[model samples]
Target chain A: MGVLMSAIGFGIVTASILAVSSVGFTLQFSVTNVFNLSFGSVMTGTGFIAYALNTSGVSIWASMAIGALCGGVISVALNWLIFGRFIRHGISRFGMVIVTIATGLICDNTIQAFVGPTFYAYNAQPGKAFNLAGMLLTGQELIIIVIAAVMMTATHVGLKSTRLGAAMRGLSVNASLARACGVPTRRVVAVAWFASGVMAGIGSVALFLDTSTFAATTGSQFLIMVIAAAVLGGVGSAEGAVVGALVVGLATEITAAYWNPELKDVVAFVVLILVLLVRPQGMFSQLSSERTAVG
Target chain B: MSAATQLYLATVSVYICVNVIASWALDIQFGVTGVLNFSFVVFQAAGAYTAAILSLGPSSSSGGFQRYVGGWRLPFPVPIIGAMVVGAVLAGVVGLVSLRRLRSDYQAMVMLVVSVIATIVAESQTGLVNGVAGISLVANPMVSLIHATRQTQIWIFVLFCVFCMALVGVVMYATVYSPFGRVLRAVRENDRAIEALGRNANRHRMQAFVIGGALAGLSGALLVEFIGAWAPNGWFYPETFVFFTAVIVGGRGSLTGVAVGAALVGVGVQQAVEYLPITLNPSVIASLEWIITGILTLVFLWTRPQGLLPERRRRFPTPWRSDAPELAERSAATKGDERG
Candidate 1:
């Protein structure tokens, strides 16, 4: 019982990180219709940016904010410079995927060359542990969960109320129709990329804090799991991403506690595959229709 | 030539042959069939491991330095054949899981996930393939069989690799230019149209996948037997892209083009980059290789999607009526291709 509760506690923290990143991933994908494989590189870049700031004596949270802003800018720049150019050049959907993957490989290797092959850690401590019932979690973990909750609520409310959010939603549903209805497709897509980058920044920092140490390849490696979570819920739904994160988080943690810890990821992947087998369109997606990439 | 030069040439020849075979396998699946098989390296790794275990003695041999399942002391050709069989069987299993009626991108994602899962499983199961340390010190079969010096054995292995590549090339040519290959290409262009014409598109994909897997296995088997090592690090998911780049640059669906592509991109770029006077660290050089590969792919896609050597477009006879007397010379000019 104690082990299970602790696993759940750990699961919540993981889910918090995953929710941020996967939501960012799914949201941009929904609007742009390009499976941006380089999203993880953005996370790695932000994480390293935060690391530099934190090591330079800035507060970690402040560094996270700055890193997230930088991530947003970088994301926008990538879309503008690379992805947008390829899309405008009349690349096929399959070709677009290869383009993103190539972009990811280039970015990842460039970062790898710059950073060299070494592990890095932030100066911030995880802080003291707090216990509730049989579950125990660090102060940092608790803070992450709180931040995730706030972010989730804000995103939900924003999507429901804000004009920008409405434009994003509109663009995702039907790009041409949304353009006809006067939604600024380019601006909304850029905003989506920015928002996604911000979430990625937050997620990468929290992930690094949880893992305690990381390398250049860490973010890209973790991306497979993030993809699993996003695909499990459905590719384009923000809410479904959150739900998928929770399920994946819980499955991995519980598997670690009960079974082989190293195979915990395998367990989460199995859950994803099972879900996909039963529901090919994912939990929240309707029958997916082929749509040309908009932004 | 000096012994050193001879050894260098032999090693280079072996790698070129292996890469060419692997690229041809990828061309069949991705280039010809349009299946984004992101887990292609897993099949190659499977073949390598199968060859390793089959050629090497039991797990208890050599003071138990490595532990793996099915370490039989098989002779010469048996291990390579075993590798191909295992590769095909593994591909069939993977195809069964991923060849569903899902979206193309979704299918690609599933294959990627499957690849990550395979790596995790291999790393975790220490007893299965001796864990991350990997199986090493695999004996080359020629050392025991041949009554010659080390150099002779190396040359013999290189010759064997060339022979294998030639055999694979002939088989690929027969398969690609055949009527069945036409169906595979049709499936790639439009699966619905093939289905309308009374062919199961998915089944055709599976067949191509299985055949490709077997060829990949053969390449891997030859490679491991020559190199004498098999590890998870060498077969990571990104390794698949090397072959993809070869196909893209060589022209997909063109066997000869892919072979030339495999030689130029797979062997040429890596070797040429190393000769640059910059003299960076080994790791950075490795990173540079990947960056160059990525940039090369992008440039090729932009400048020439048809590649350096494009797939030959087959033309059929457009029968004209005898009434159109003036069009006789024009019809002769638009000659049909020698596809067969």
Candidate 2:
């Protein structure tokens, strides 16, 4: 019973961390139709930025905000400077994936050079650990859960009630149609990229808040998890990302707890392949993609 | 130039020759056939590992630094042949499962997963190629018989690489011009149409993948023999992209273009690193080089998609359509889809 409880606790925290990135990644993929492999690079960059801010004696909250803003700006810049040109030239989608990957490599290695190849520990005071139903709980982990929930609610509300969010939904479904309808498709795409970037930054911050150290490969390694969550949850659906995150997060943590810890990541990879092989379109893509209009 | 300089040039020539073959094989797969083979390097690694274990004689518990499978003493040429076979068999198996009808993006992702999985398995399973510690192949295959100096051996190696390159070039030339090449090209352009014509498109792709894998394996086998060591660190998925970048930056489907791109990326970049002042820490310098390589790859793809040397279109004399009835109908169907 104690093992089960702790495993469940592990699942929730893992899910919360995954949700932050998966939602952002799904949104970017849906709108741009380009799998921005550089998303991992951006995540790592935001992590470093947060580390720098924290080291300079800023509060954790302030550091997170700064990291998010920097991520957003970087995303916006990449769109304007790099991806925008490729789309304009009518490059093949397959080619674009390679382009993104190479760019990600460049960004990752450049940051590695700057960081001197050593891992950085974001020095934050560890809050006291408490017991909840025989499961040890950290205050930071609990706060991350709150952050994920609040962010999801805000995202849900934004999509349903706001004009910008509605435009985003329209553009994602059919860019040409959205453009024909005078929806300012390019601007919507830029905004979506920025929002996704911010989400990735937040995810990075949350992860480090729990682990206390960051490396160049941190985001890229987590990217596999983010991708798994995004795909399992159903592409382009925020709700699906959260639920998918919970499923994968729990399965991985429990398997690690019960089975060999070294094989935990292998379990996740196996699940991803199985899910993809069984259902390529996604589990939750029930309604039309256009249903985002009413979301 | 001095004798030492001449010797260095000969050694570098061999390096360029081997890499060029590997790069061209990758170009044919990715450039002409449009398969994103992120595991390209691993195929080569497979060849290296196979060749190393087969030739290493026997492993002692303490004297040798690593433990591995297939501790047999074999002749040099035997391992090279074994390397090619290893690549073909592995490629065939991987192609069947991964190349099943799926979205291209999904296919690429699966390939990436395959490479990542292979890396982990290779690193973790100590019995497999001695795990991360790696295995070193005995370098001097003919030192006993040839009785040549180091300088002479280097020249001999250079000639060997040149010979391999010539063989590869001849084969590529034959393939790209043959009837089979035409079918491969047609399938690459449109798989469904070629399949409708009763040609197994997937089979053709599998063949291309296998051939490319074999070539990659050959390159690896040769490289490991020259370097005298094989490590898990030798193969990374990103290294595959470096080859991809070369293919793209050199016009795809053009041999000369691949060669040019190979020189610029494979040799030019490495040479550029050599010229940099040794002011910073050594590791920092190495990291910077990789970052620059990555940035160059991205910039080339974004700004110059056609590459430095664009593919020149060949004009072949059109043969009269003897089977006009089927050809006309098939073309019409494809045109209709595009219109829709």
Candidate 3:
């Protein structure tokens, strides 16, 4: 019972990080409809930015805020410079996917060239562990959970209440219809990218803090799990991302606590593949793809 | 030529052969069939491991250094054949699960996920293929069979690889140019239209997947046998993009083009990078290679989607109605579906 409770605690922390990143991922995907394989690079970039700040004696939280803003700017710049150009060039859907892949490879390798294969860690501390009901969590993990809750609430309210949110949703469902409805297509899309980047920054920092050490490829490595959570909940849905992250986070931690630690990730992947094969539409996704649209 | 130069040439030739086979395998799936097989390197790794385990002595026998399943003391041809079979079977299993009526993008993500799963399992399970350090010191088949000097044995292995390449080439020619090839191309063009004509497009894709898997396995088996090592580091998911770049550069659906592409991209890029005037870090050089590949893909996609040597447009002499003389050239830019 004690083990399970601690596992749940770790799961919550993991879920917190995943929820931030996946929501960022899914939201941009919702607006642009491009599966940004390079989103992980944004996380890595922001993590390093925070690293640079922390190493130079800046406070970690302040660095996080600045790093997040940089992440937003970087993501928006990537769209404006590369993705937008390719889309305007009128590449096929298959071509678009390939183009994004090329973009990601370029980004990842560029980072690799500069950083080499070395691993890095933040200058901040994990602080003291607080035991709450059997689940022991450090100060950092607790802060992360609260931040995730706040971010989720903000996104939920923003999407539900704000005119900008309505325009974004409108664009996701039908771009042409939304344009006809006078939604500023270009502005909303860019805002989505920015928002996604900010979330990526926060998520990557939380993840790095929890994991302790990091590297250039860390974001891409964790990307598969982020993708799994998003896919499990259904692509392009923020609420589903949270649910999916919790499910994945708990399943992985519980599996580790009970079974071989090495196989914990394997269990989460098995669930992903099964869910993908059995239900590609996912649990919470409303827009059925043409392949799954029919009876 | 010096003996060292002679040995170097032979090794390069063997590498060329291995890459050509692998690229053709990828071409059949991605180029001709339009299946986004992002987990391609996994098939090659599977074959390499299969060959290594079959040929190597039992893990507990020689100093008990490495641990893995199925360390049979098999002879020359058996391990290579075993590798191909295992590759096909793995492909079949993966295809059955992923090749359903899902969206193409979704299918691609599944392939990526599968690739990640394979890597995690390989890295985590220490007993399986000796974890990260990998299986090494795999005896070249020629060294054991023929009693000769090391150079002579290596030359013999090179000959065998060339022979295998020729056989695979013949098989590729037969499959791609035949009526079956036409159907496969049709499936890539529009699967819906083929279904309307009473052909199961999904089954056709599965067939391509299995065939590609076997050939990819053969390539890996040959590579491992020559290089004498198999490890998780060599088969990461991003490695698939290298093959995709080869197909795109060489001209998809063209056998000759793809072989030329495989040689140029796989061999030529590394050689070119080596000759750069300024000294640099090894890791930086690796990054440069990828960046160049990424750039090359973008440039080719933008300018010459048909490639330098485009797929030959077959001419059907329609004397009854001389409307069009040859099949239309489908540029990679706008060849297949406009949108998924």
Candidate 4:
């Protein structure tokens, strides 16, 4: 029972953060049709932003917001400046993949240069813990869970009701068709970049809050897990991303708890391979041959 | 030259040659065949580990700097043989599991996962490849035969590398001309059409993957021999991208381009580092180098995706431009040679 409850606690925490980042990741993929490997770099950027603000005497919440805003701004800039130009040039999906990787390397190492070569703590105070069924839990973890739930609900409602959300959904389904229908497709894509950036920022801060430290390579290292969650959940489906996150989080935590911790990461990768092999469309989605075609 | 300076030159020279070969191995696999192959570094790691273990003799019962398997102080040639065999075996296993018909992105992900798994295994299992402590390979095979002078060692190693590169080049050239190479290209160009023609596309892809893996392994063995160290930190997924950058920057599907790319991006960029002032932090300079490489790759993609010398397109001759056939004929012949 103790093991089960602790695992549940781990699952919830993991799922919350995963949902935030994966949703942003999927949103960007859906709208832009770019895999955006550099998304993880932006996550690190936000992490550093929050770290910088906190060091300069800001509350964690305010720092999180600033970091998210920074991410939003950077995302918009990248789309406007770099990726959009490449897309206009008729570069293939493979080319875009390489571009994203190059962009990521640039961002990661630039940060490494500025931050030096060591991990630094964000200096956020750990809050009081509440024991729930023999699991040591923190207030921040609960807050993150709440944030995730709120974000998911708000995102669902926005997509279904708001004009902007409808435009985004239409664009995601068929960009050319949406443009033909006069959905302001370019603006929608830009909004997506902004939104994805915000989520990446908030999610990265939450990660740092949980771990209480930051490093240049933190986002890059954590990105493999994020990619696993996003791809496993279904890249274009926000809801699928959340569900996928929950499953992956639970799987990772349980494996770490019961088996060798050294093998936890390897197990996560194995899960990624298994998911791709078993259900390319995701756990909840209907079988669509298009799902397995490409990213 | 002073003995120490000569030794330094030797080491650096060996480094360049080793990386050039490794980069070529990657270029042929990825650039020519369009395989992402994120696990490229692992093959090199395997070869290094194999060569190191075979040349390290038995593990100490009580204490030792590094612990590994198949400890035997084999002669120089034997270690190279061991490296090639290990690479072939590992490549076969990886190819069997991952070279099936799959989405390119999915294939890339699988390779990445394999790389990560290999790193974790290397780091965690102390009994396996010394568990991040790594094995320090000794350059003792020819110690008795040679005078053991730094200049002699440098020249001999340089000769060894050149000989290996020539051998690899001949083998690769032969492969490019072979029927198998044509089939591989056919599969790469259009697997569905090839399948209609009754060729087993997946099998061809697996064959290419395994052969590429062996090349990578050979390169790795050569590298470890020069450096005398084989560690987990040596092989990272990003290193794969460095080669990708080189191949792309030079030109894909062209041997000249691949070599030029390796020379420019792989060696040229590193050489550029020598010009940087010593006052600035080394890490900062390194970071700037990566950023530059990344930017150049992007700029090349957006503006000149075809590269400095784009893969030449074949054209039929017309009365207006009668010289087209001559150009085409020359290119066709070169392309034929390149395929082999």
Candidate 5:
């Protein structure tokens, strides 16, 4: 019973991080209609930026903000420079996927060349553990949970209430239709890239905080799980991402606790395969006609 | 040629042959069938591991270094044949699940996820092909049959690889020219149309996938035999991208083009990048190779998507046929309309 509760606590913490990253991933996919495989490399790049900042004596909070800002900038640059050009040149969406994968290779290797391959430790020390209802948690984990909740709430409110969010949502549903309806799609897309990049950046920091040690391939390693969560939650839905993350997180942690720890990552792949096989449109997706086909 | 130069040429020849075979395998899948099989390296790895274990003999429980199934001490051709069977079986299973239910993009993502999962499983479960440490010191098949020096043995191996390459090329060429090849092209152009024509498109894809997997396995077997080692790191996910890039750069749906592309990208560019006198660390140089390949793929897709030698028009009738004009005209029109 104690082990189960503690696992659930850890699961919640993981779910929080996954929610942030998965939502960000789904957001990009929603607006750009590109899978954005390089999103993982962006996460790694921002994580390294935060690491550099922390090593250079910046406050952790400040470093996170700066890292997120860098992420947003880079994300927008990628969209504008690479993906945008490909789209303009009439590259198929599948071709865009290949292009994004290439971009990921470039970004990941560039980081590897600069940083080398050794693992770097995040500088923050863990605070005292707090127990609530037989579930023990650390101060950092608690903070992460709170931040995730706040971010999710903020995203929800923004999407529901703000004009930009509405435009973003409208664009995600149908870019041409949204443009026909007088939505500023180009600007909305840029905003979507920025917003998603910010989430990825902050999520990377939270991931680093949770894991403490990371390398160039760390973000890429986590990418599959993020993709799984995003796809499971329904590719374009923010709330669906959170729900998907919770399910993935709980399933992974519980499986790790009960089964072999080495199989933890395998659980996510299983879930992804199952979801793809059962419902490729995702569980919460309302759009039935958006069926993907080979070009 | 000097011994060192001879050895270098031999090594490069072997690699070129292996990559050509693998590229052809990928060409059948991606270029001909339009299945973006991102988990390609997994099938190749499976073949390598299967061949290694079969030739290495049974794992000794006492040898605390590594563990794997089957130490059958199979002879020269048996292990290689075993690899092909294993590769085909694995591909059939994977294709069955992925092709039946998912769309192309989702299928590609699932394959990518599968590739990663396979890697993780290999790394974590040390018992399976000895995990990340991998199986090493695999003896060259039939090395004892020839009473020759090591250099001569390597030359003989090079000849063997050349023969294998020629055999694969001939078989692939035949397959491409056969009626089945036309069906594959039709499926690639429009599976829905093929289905509407009362043919199972998915079945055709699975057949191509399995055939491709078998060829990939054969390539892996040949490669492992040459290197005398197999490891998880050797078959990374990005490795699949390298093959895909080769097919694209070579020209899709053309066997001769695949050969040229594999030679240029797999051997020429790779060797050149590897031998560059950059002051960076070797690992960085390796990373640079991937970066260059990625950039190369993007540039090709952007500038000349048809590649340098675009696939030739599929000939419809043999020259012996006197009534070829109408069929030829129809084929020419269809060829112009074909987009894959």
Candidate 6:
């Protein structure tokens, strides 16, 4: 019982990080319809940037801010440059996927070229664990949970209340229609890219806080789970991503705690496969009319 | 040429031949059938392990250094056949689920996940092919039959690889010219129309997938036999992207193009990087190679989507011929039906 409760606690922490990344992923997909495989590399790059700053004696909070700013800039550049060119060339969605994969490879290998294959640790002392109701968590983990909750709430309120958020949602639904309705579709898309990139950057910092050690390929390694969460939740739905992340996180942690640790990663994949098989449209997808064809 | 140089050339030749076979295997699926099989290396790894275990003889009671099933101590031909069979079976199983239901993008993601999961399993399960250490010390087939220096033996192996490549090429050529190939292309272009014509599109895809998987297995078996080892590290997910880039650069649906692309990208660029006189770290060079491959893929995708040699249009009998008009009419009617 104690083990189970602790696993749940760890699961919530992981779920929080996954929610941040997955929400960013879904937001990008919702607005741009690009799938954005390079988001993984962006996350890793920002994490490394944060690590470098922290090691250089900068405060962690400041490093995170700068990392997120860089992430946003780079992500916007990718959208305005590479993806925009592909879209202009009339590349199909599938073609865009291939392009993003290429972009991801380039980004990952570029980082590896500079950093080599070595891992780096964040410059932070381990905090003491706090136990409450038989569940154990560290100070950092508690802070992460609180930040995730606040972010989720803020995003919910922003989307429901703000004009820019309304414009973003409208663009996601129908870009041309949104433009016709006097919404600034292009600006909204740019904002979406920057916002998602910021989310990815912050999420990477949280991930580094949780894991402490990371390598150039760390973000790509976590990519499958982020993709699984976003797709399982409903590709365009942020709230659904949180729900999907919770399920994946709890399942992975519980399996790792009780069963073999190595099998934990496999649990998310199995769930993804099951979800794809049973409900191809995902949990909260609104676009049921679009059927996928092979060509 | 120096003896050492000759030996190196022979080894490189063997690899080139193996890559050609693998490229053709991928061409059949991704090129001809339009199924983006991102987990292609998994099929190859499956074949490699099957061949290794089958030919490695029985394990000890304690299961030797690496634990695996079916230590049959099979002969050369038997292990190769076993590899092909295993590849086909695995493809059939994977295809039944993914090809039948999922969209193309989803299928790609699922296969990627499967590849990652397979690697994790292979790395962690000590009972399966010795975990990360992988299976080594694989005896080369028919080594006893040859009485010559090591260099000469390598040349002989190269000859054998050339023979295998020719055989695979001939088979692939036959498939391309056959009516079945036309139907496969039709399915790729429009599966719904193919379904309307009273044929199962999914079944055709599965057949192509199984055949491609068998060829991939054959390539893996040949590669492992030559290298005398198999490891999880050798068959990473990125390896599949390399093959895809080759197909794209060569020409997806063209067999000859696949050969050319494999030669250029798989053998040429990779080997060229090794011989470059750059004074950089080896890791930097490796990363540069990957970056080059990524750039090549993107360039091809953006500018030359059809590849270096676009697929040649298949010629049919002229309308003056007795049966040509009727066949043409039927095709036109099918197209009209689809558009309507």
The sequence of per-residue lDDT tens digits that candidate 1 reaches over residues B112-194 is 99889999999999999888988887778889989999999999888889999999999999999999999999999889999
Q: Can you list the residue pairs that collide in candidate 4?
A: B173-B340, B176-B339, B176-B340, B177-B339, B177-B340
Give TM-scores for every candidate, taking all chains together and pairing residue i with residue i.
Answer: 0.96, 0.91, 0.95, 0.92, 0.94, 0.94
For model 1, what is the C-alpha lDDT against the true structure?
A: 0.89
State the lDDT at B326 in candidate 1: 45
- Provide interface RMSD per model, one decimal: 4.0, 4.2, 2.4, 4.1, 1.8, 3.7
Model 5 chain A: weakest 10-residue lDDT segment is A286-295
Candidate 2: clashing pairs of residues: none
Model 5, residue B328: C-alpha shift (Å): 8.9
Compared with the true structure, what per-residue lDDT tens digits does model 3 show for residues A1-295? 9999999999999999999999999898888888888888889999999999999999888889899999999999988887776776665566667777887788888888998989999998888999999999999899999999999999999999999999988878888778888988889989999999999999999899988999989988888889889988899899999998998999899999998888877788789788877787765887545311100
| Candidate 2 residue lDDT tens string, A59-102 | 88789889999999998888787777766766676667877787
Q: Which of candidates 1 and 3 is the stronger one according to TM-score?
A: 1
Q: If ranked by TM-score, best first, what sequence of candidates would result?
A: 1, 3, 5, 6, 4, 2
Q: Pick the candidate with the highest lDDT.
A: 1
Tens-place lDDT digits, model 5, residues B1-340 = 8899988898899999999999999999989988889999999999999899888877884375668866778778999999999999999999987898576777888899889989989998888888888998787774865878888888898899899999999998888778898889888888889999999989999999999999999999988988888888988788898898899898899888888999988888878887787677888987888888888889998887777788887555768878787779877887674333
State residue B309's C-alpha deviation in candidate 4, in Å: 3.9
Model 1: residues with Cα > 4 Å off, grouped in runs: B320-340
lDDT of 4 by residue, B1-340 (tens): 8887787677766666676677767766776566778888899889888888887788783267667765887877888778878887887887766666556665776787788889999999888878887888456344545786756766787778888887887787688556776676677667789999998877777777778878888888888877778788768777788777777787775556766777788767876875776667888887877887898798778666666665554345666766877877787777653221
On the 0 to 100 scale, the lDDT of residue A13 in model 3 is: 95
For residue A166, model 2's alpha carbon misses the true position, in angstroms, by 2.6
lDDT of 2 by residue, B1-340 (tens): 7888986687678678877888888877777777778788888898888777667776763377778876777876887888889988998887886677646676777677778778777887888788887887456454443678877776777787789898998998798667887777777677889999999887888888999989888888888877889888778667787687778777777788888887777777877887787667766676666776777766766667767786554444335867766766666667543210
Candidate 4: segments with Cα more than 4 A from true spot = A281-295, B61-63, B144-148, B312-340
- In candidate 3, stretches whose alpha carbon ends up further than 4 angstroms from where it belongs are A290-295, B315-340
Give the best candidate by DockQ: 5
Once superposed on the true structure, which residue ranges of model 5 sit more than 4 Å away at CA? A288-295, B61-64, B315-340
What level of docking quality does candidate 6 show? medium
